[model samples]
Target: MEGIKRIYLLIGQKGSGKSFIGTLMEKEFGIKFIRVEDWAKKIKKDRNVDSEAYLKQVFEENENEIRDSLTDMDKIVFESTGLTEHFDIMLESLRRDFKES
Candidate 1:
């Protein structure tokens, strides 16, 4: 069997089952899940802002981590609201990494 690293971008509105899907993916694929909100808190140490700014910083930081992980991990699940510019930036960064890799 061939092994490939995957970076899943879960995009959905509130209460749209993003978390549920992430959990399912983790169980079914044995992939590690990285939630943007939790990552932002760990990265920035601030949780008082609204989702918009939080997600932006998360994307910026998470994208770098994702790129780094791709070299070692089999799969990484990026769980996010996917409704902000930050998400788009992260996606673009992922694409660039894919091309470079």
Candidate 2:
């Protein structure tokens, strides 16, 4: 339906090719892929070795702030390693915060 919004969240460990799967979905289904890690990097730049991990943690911790970066889009796909300490917290927060609003 036009009013329906579908968001596919892909979760896995580091180097687990979650993005590869997302890419395939994008290519096959024309679904737009949005990687949370990329948004995290845009919000806070890190040059350290574990920057990816740090950005993910920051994103999950500040779900509200990151959510602001999101726009109204349907059939969206998000892939993450779920290595952040607050991965579940972020998901729960997003569910509660972004419900048909």
Among the numbered candidates, top TM-score falls to 1
lDDT of 2 by residue, 10-67 (tens): 8888778988888899899987776766666665654563666665556664554345
Each candidate's clash count: 0, 0
lDDT of 1 by residue, 20-72 (tens): 88888889988777776677668566465566776677778888787777778
Top candidate, metric lDDT:
1
Q: After superposition, how far is residue 6 of candidate 1 from its true place, in Å?
A: 2.0
Which ranges in model 1 have alpha carbons more than 4 Å from their true place?
1-3, 43-48, 51-55, 99-101
Q: Which run of 10 residues does model 1 get worst, by summed lDDT?
A: 92-101
Provide TM-scores for the models. Answer: 0.74, 0.63
